[model samples]
Target: MKLARLGVLIDEAAMKRLHSYGLNVFERYIEEILEHAGAPFETITDIRALDDRGFDIVIASVVPENEETAERLWQYAEHGGTLIAYGGLGLLARRLGCRQRPRTGAGYARLPEFRSVPAPLRCLSAQPWHAEDAGAGAIGALHASSPQGELVGPALQTFAVGRGAIHRWAVDIPTTVVQLQQGTRPVLHDGIPAPDGTADIDEGILKADDDIELDWEWDREKTATGMPYFAYPHADYWREALMAHLVRCALAKDRTLPLLDYWPEGTGHVALISFDSDFNEDERAVVTLDVLKKLQIPSTWCMIEPGYSPQVYERVLAEGHELALHYNALEKENGIWSLEEFTRQRQWVQSATGLARVVSNKNHYTRYEGWGELFRWCEANGIAADQTRGPTKRGNVGFLFGTCHPYFPIAWCDEGNRRYDVLEIGFLTQDLNHPNLSDTTVIEPFLKQVAKVGGVAHFLFHQIHIHRLEPVRQAIREVVGKARQMGFAFWTSKQINDWQRARRTMRVTGIDAAGQVRLERGTVNEPVAVWLPTSEAPESIQSPGIVYRYGVPCIKQVHHLTREEAEC
Candidate 1:
């Protein structure tokens, strides 16, 4: 099946603002979506270039400013090209069969096609819109509900233009998504309300929980104790919705796009279980290691300063587990929160364990301050992954950052808006045994949601609790069993970091006229999955399985060989 050529038009000026203290998200969010979807796309800065290149699908993320660019896009779509655009397209809106009305300051929007309820959507323009008539040819795919439960107008409208079509999102999706992921910059020092009673205000450190962007009353479902049990994954859901539309449009043109699977060998889902070794509890570490051995699951042990004896570290490595640094930034005793302190701790752990490199780290108290600083420190230190952006309080337990997948965070401080080299694999909740915080109740639902998105379900536990508290020990065992039963393979953080970074290097050059997928792969040591949408399963496949790509059936095949072997 010939795949449609995909291109994202960039607004140069808007992109420039994204790096600065401006609200425009531009192509950053779009780049994130395509990266997660594993779709091969090019970034187009010039509008006229769309003509000669003949892109089958163009994402008009950059709303045309002048008449010439707008006319070019209109002509391209009229001549049979799918154009997916966000926000307003100015005068071109009426020409494409959409009508705009007075904008409203609403907080939410819903895409009924995804069976979605109203999720938090912050308009970068500070105004959420409801389309007027959208004309007769336009169909509303997403809409915002009124106070009395009426669908007043559409946020996303589709219009059939000549031989092609245009899907327009009336709201600013890029800024909303980036906000959902990174949260507001210069986080308020006052901190969000901690009604669940987990906030330790005396710490004087701006913890990760301090910057909770998800609304406690609106974005989460509560438990009996008024703590959050279910956090609606608005970011992930929106991403999936966008990808679904892209796949649908591609299929309409008799094209099938190849998507990269999240896990190796067509695994249904993936999970990561980690332990924070607080105060270097060697005895507690032993008990936890024993449990891991019994379950045959490899885990990541985030070792703090003056970590366990050499024997314990050796045992962790011998058991095929990962030894990662657990940086101490809490105010216990001389716990500093700076790059220099982070480096000192990292070096201490390396010297203590006699290890050459430490690939991952997580803060002691989930201690986070400011935005992008920690990421920059990790980048400088060669830390490939960090698991610090998660809930430290009960009220904001699940998907607080609105993602379960490991992603490279963008350095908002950078003038170029470059993504940090570090990957953030945020955990759902820490210490299920912690009273009023989390328990086994969150396990099934959390894992289910992660599996739904084919993302990594990461859980954190403390060695002290795992050994001293029987309930915590039991909780870990039960979660492991359930995860395995649900087709989730438990992997170390290093493994996940390695896999995601490796997969990012594999490029889909294109799909040929003969229906063959051309690939450009980096040095891959483990299996990477590439899914091709097909009407029927191929007769010959290397470790093939049946899967769905944005609701379309596809045959998933794993690539395990090197570039040379693949060519042969």
Candidate 2:
């Protein structure tokens, strides 16, 4: 089956509105969602090309330029192509049997059951619509508190049209994605000051052996930042829905488009064990390394250049562990770090480790402001991956951007939009964020979520803290033990980075009607998992790599080096 060619109508005016507010609104998020779903699409800016005969389906935000373009959209929908319009496009709404009501201020809505689970839908501002007529049905609903009190209405509606269909969404999906991507959340009035007398708006800190209590405040109106409110807890839900809807639309037009497998080689889940060399204590570092050695697990040590010594660097390399940089500001004021200083640190680490280039890094304190410049530095310096997207403190913990998967970070600038070459391997769980460092059970919930999604379970452990705090050590041990028992493949950060980079480069050049798939290009000498959307299992498998799973097609490329040649 050939891939469906999706046409996305770009609304210049709507894009301008987002850019005016320093947001990289639409394209990147849409591309990411589509790519993850294995859906191929192209952008159409000219309204003259909005013909029903041109594309299998056309998607446009409610903010169309003029009446002419809007009319063209109607014709496109009425003639014979699936039209998906978001927000309150009057013509599209009426055609979809939906009537738009008054605006419901920014709030969160409970999505209808997706994959048998009710996910939360967070919107800055939502326009409620309902399917009141036949030949149409509500797919999802938005639940919000309004002036008339609590109300529920269709957030997504579908209607059958002449030889085609119209899918309308009341919630602003692009805006939500942009907000989550930027980590922009409205300031909640429930503010608490840090011990240093600074305002700690969204940060929480937990000590070792402390009580485990989870509190999520959902008062929509109480925000200090004056920004529109968004639901952070289920950001991934909204993203998943956006992708699912795109796939559904494509399938409706043509069902031959194959769904991409999430993990490489159809592995259920992946685990990454990493340590932040924040403290320069060699003994503490040795203790942590000793534990990992006993478990026979290879971990990535993100070493601080200033805190690192020749002895420790040699020891880590000799033990068959991965070495990465923990880039930190040499002289810091207000958490800001200079690019030149970062380069100096990188050179220092390279000189000490005797490696010409480093592939991975995590910012000290995760203070990643001036990200555009920071990422530019990474690309220029040959850094391939980063883990700085994790929460800096306890308060801001939990899935930021709602995904545990790695993606190319979008760089939003006044000049234009660009995606960096570096991969952002996000940290899903961290030991310091919890109040009870000794409590290993806190991490199980995160592990469970990742397993449920077949996502990466990346853990962050600080060497100094783990050595000083026995509970932290215990917690790490328990989490690792449970994850092993659950069948997670433990990998170093570099290994995961290599696999993801290869996966992104890989392409399914062709698939025939008989379901025979062909890969034209991919990472050479690297293992990859190819997903085939067929009930009948695959036969006549051909590859040099070992097949971990036959049906789903998890293949490890034949390694040229001997066991002694490769790091153990």
Candidate number with greatest lDDT: 1
Residue range 1-568, candidate 1, lDDT tens digits: 7877888987676456444564435345688778867888898876768887788899988544678878888888899998887765766766754446655543556554543333444332322243445353333333333222334456566777788887777666665666677776745464756555544433466777676556555666765544465466776776776776677677778877788877666566899999999867789989998988999999998988778999998999999999999988877667887899999998998998888999999998877777788888898888999999787766568887878888877756343666778888989988886664677777887888898877789999998898888888888988898998999998899999988888788788887675557777765556777878764444544434766666666766566776676676
Pairs of residues at least 3 apart in sequence or in different chains that clash in candidate 2? 187-224, 203-395, 204-395, 206-435, 265-529, 265-554, 545-556
For model 2, what is the error of residue 500's alpha carbon versus the real structure, in angstroms, after optimal superposition?
A: 1.9
Which pairs in model 1 have colliding backbones? none
Q: Runs in model 1 with CA error above 4 Å?
A: 11-14, 17-26, 97-106, 114-152, 194-204, 222-227, 512-514, 525-527, 534-546, 557-568
Give the Å shift of residue 548 in candidate 1: 3.6
RMSD of 1: 3.7
Model 2: how far is 30 from its true place, Å? Answer: 0.5
lDDT of 1 at 25: 51
